[model samples]
Target chain A: MDTKAYIASGILELYVAGQLSEKENLEVAEYAETYPEIKKEISEIEAAVLALSEAAAPNKPLSFEAVKNRVELSEDTKLIPLNRGRNRWLPYVGWAASAALLAGLGYFYNQNNQLRSDIKLAETEIQALEEQIAGASDSLEKTTALLQTLRDKNVTVIPLGGQVAAPEAYAKAYWNETEKQLFIDAQGLPEPPDGMDYQVWSLTLNPLTPTSVGLLENFQTDENGVFALSNPNQSQAFGITLEPAGGSESPNLEQLYVLGTVSS
Target chain B: MQLEELVERFKQKDLRAFEQLYAMYARNICGAINTIVRDEVLAEEICQDVFVKVWEKSDAYNSSKGRFFTWVLNIARNAAIDELRSKSHKNQKLNLSADYFVGILERADDEPNGNVNTDRIIGFIKNLKQKCIELIDLIYFKGYSQKEVSESLDIPLGTVKTRNRNCISQLREHMKQN
Candidate 1:
């Protein structure tokens, strides 16, 4: 490419006038990009033309803002303040200070949140431990009162051996005559089947009469494995049987788990 | 090429970049329109609309097409010509013989300090031949294509670019001196 010859061709003038086709315009742009001298020539030509056009403009032409207002293509942005810094690097220094301040504020904000969450976690753990302690002390107090009742001298203890239904089961009955309360210690008893309860019976010797004692309700939840029932019928002997949820009309003798005699 | 960068950003709808471009070309575009329309107020009106149209049609412009000024100049010329075709412009023609824009500088001499742009611009064309003035007005201000200029001026088709080049060179020489 003879750059001087291309510059002398005057094709660049028409290019500035936009008289060329698309292909010619692209070719001119390519040459301008590649050749500095050609680009300079084009700029000079453009300046001369620009001057003529500017002279022909209205004496009181509208301001740039006025022309800008006629369009809504994101031209409504607020004017950014131009830098009024004294030194060349003042803006860079200001920006650095701002960024550092923002980072410091962010760090402290995160630290404050972390401390607050730690304090909350400690408070929650303390509350849960306090509830557990209250529950344990309440259970211990109930078990201690039951232990004291077992030692009362007016209460007679009867050992009941497992019947044919469960030969391995055993229990003790503490019969308090004054209180009419019979405490059954059923540590050796197997859990009752689903939808069933353990019913106690007070028996008479000759006629084999059976009187109802209260069922062991909530047998599954008794952690101490001991139950008490009211027995006022002068029970001669005692038997434990697995009956349906409500006590039966008579003991299902086939399911009797324990039998004991009340010693004189 | 900061101007190139600005034009690229302007095409991407960057309002700030477009502001720079509007400042750069708005006056020249209005002046060009005034030459065609020969009414300062009406030319300013058309010039405002032309920039808005330029923004709306920015996608139609890119570095690949031609000079950004040329694109804008083409738009202003069309808009000004369109206004002239309207019935209202028929009555507003200041001089039916005003075939060139140098008359603008002559008209500006009557104004006070507002004559600064035309004053300096008048110096550039002070030594220009009448043919130079007509060619400049037709090619740069009127956006006449090479073929259109040749046919209108009755010149051979091949001579338009060289003749335009001579006229613009004289403009550059005057611009350098002033």
Candidate 2:
């Protein structure tokens, strides 16, 4: 089974918290004995909990005598001393040594479990941090690419001022005439209403004609709010109009949100 | 001696073994009781009773069931909650606040209160998220089950374990920082 995934699932923490069911408790104990890493994790989680609960202890220490006096010891049991003969002493010695050996084994098992878990935690932490670094580097590369495109000499940056339909709205168009590609920075435009979309049009001002380019779909959810469309037409100006979900064959002049003339 | 050995000796009615285990967990058990009872002197009294009960019921504990700490923790909390419920008719009705151990931290340092480990406790929980604090209190202190925690916190059932793991992870980071 995926022991690492099981460890990461947080079940061990609940096990230490004693929140798991009877079956789950037995399963965890079994896992702890079988998997050193799980055992180590259970130990650390137990320790963290122990520390928090310990810290909540009242300022005054509870007298050991207080607890000692209240607890009744078994009167029948008595400790046998080693002052007697060798034969009598040998069994006691044997039991003591076996107990000692058992204790030693338990101690080493605990230590080994602890070390393995420490290494596992360190590895998981390092993995999380590496993922973060990779994510940051990925975003940095994309930003750098966007910066290069904006600085390209062949691209014309046309500032599209807000139109009367929505005076506060604005957008920018980066027209690469040679490549016939238009990049729109629609960051300044408000979100299109439900079931509506913003459509871009390439216009030839001489006859007041406009050809629909593309609709900015998924505008609200898009992180950058930038749309790129191919505009192969020999256009004199550009305008954006809001229309029903899909782009219209002809631009709706009244719904024009922004317009800008391209200077030749 | 290893914890298993100590616990073995404890189960065999060895006073020294009981003393060792008591010393290891007395404050923690008492603190846990205090979270429920909300009174230091009363909590101490209940804490002592809990230890005595631990001795009487030593044979019931098994490694397979749970950790020794967790076993005793259940005893301590149950005793405290019983004490609170029994006194429900008193003039000062006991309300087991959900805040748990944070009460000691928020109390003034000069007040006549159980302030011994408040500083360390504050350091341990410093900068922890509020949700983490509540989760720890509910599960660790109040002994809520996974389903109960999900319902009380209004989060998805599957989220409780993973979310709790992350919270405790943050808590461990706080401990390291201190």
Candidate 3:
């Protein structure tokens, strides 16, 4: 290719002025790259245009930083933060935080309820144990009193044999004549039927007269069937009979379960 | 060392390369804008805007397309022309015909600061034909292509290229002499 003829064509000048189309510009660019003379010619043309324009320029030139700052400011203004505005990523992060917080609160609430129930169960257990201790103490006091009565010098011990109503039922009574109190052990008796109770009576055997002393209401449920009854009458014997609900006005003779006598 | 290397670095978004490139052409760009806009302040402002645009659009530029200075010059010309066409400048003296590089020389000569030796410019211009002046003005300063110059100057289409070559050769000789 005649590089000089191409240079003389004034295309390089138009190329520098950006008047050439893309293909022509690329051709010129290739030519300029390949040939140093072509390159120098293009540069000289650019320099002439530059000098012309510079002479036409105002006396003072602008600072490059000022222009760069404007560029930077424009970029800063245009850049939206990832979290700002209606970003696609923002909703996902927000939902994730909300879900995590909800789960945490739910877990804490469940734990709180479980702890509360545990405390309630513990309180109930403590109440039940307290009741058991009180009952045991009361039973111990009753047994000690009964032992003192049996060891008393003026007390007479009598054995009661089972009668026709329950032939296997037996009982024992300790009479403290000075104190007018009788302590009966009816542990050998069977449980009375529902709505029925066992009543003990002080009796005079010669006249066959009976006086009601006390009724054992909770016969089956009582762990120890030791009962303390007042026997103020001059009793020669004691009788136990099964009576109807709320205890009978007089003992049903047919229901007599045991009988015992105390000698003077 | 070469202008190609600087332009290549500029394309790669090298700030230092861009600064060097700006220093090389900023005065020319301001001169070109001042020629058209005729207001130094407005020309400087537009010149800065043009350079910034060149930096931003550097990627769009390819040596295959044109010279980097040509690209920057095109930007300055378009910006100045756009400013002239804007609504605000509509009422201001509409001397669209006088919007040329020669107009700058004329305006400068009229100014107090234009004491700088314009004899070189005047002597160079004195030898050129009036048609050459209009052709150079349209094709170079106003960024008109050959066909537009032909149509605007009512000349033969083939004459625009040859005539422009001669005119530029004369200008280059004058520049060398100065």
Off by over 4 Å in 3: A1-5, A33-40, A67-200, A211-227, A230-264, B8-17, B56-61, B79-98, B114-119, B122-130, B176-178
Best by TM-score: 3
RMSD to native, candidate 3 = 8.2
Candidate 2, residues B1-178, lDDT tens digits: the string is: 9998999989988989999999999988998887777778898999999998998889888876689999999999899878877885355564343455677545524454545455655766757888888888888988888888888888898899999999998888777676
Judged by lDDT relative to the true structure, which candidate is superior, 1 or 3?
Answer: 1
- Candidate 1 segments exceeding 4 Å error: A73-264, B90-98, B112-117
- What digit string (tens of lDDT, one per residue) describes model 3 on residues B74-133? 888899989988948888775554545676676665664643545356556656777777
Report, for every candidate in turn, its global Cα lDDT versus the true structure.
Answer: 0.84, 0.84, 0.81
| Fnat, 2 decimals, each candidate | 0.85, 0.73, 0.72
Best by DockQ: 1
- TM-scores of chain B alone in all candidate structures, in the order given: 0.88, 0.89, 0.86
Docking class of 1: medium
Candidate 2's error at A141, in angstroms?
99
Model 2, A69-133: lDDT tens per residue?
77743232223233335666789999999999999999999999999999999999999999989
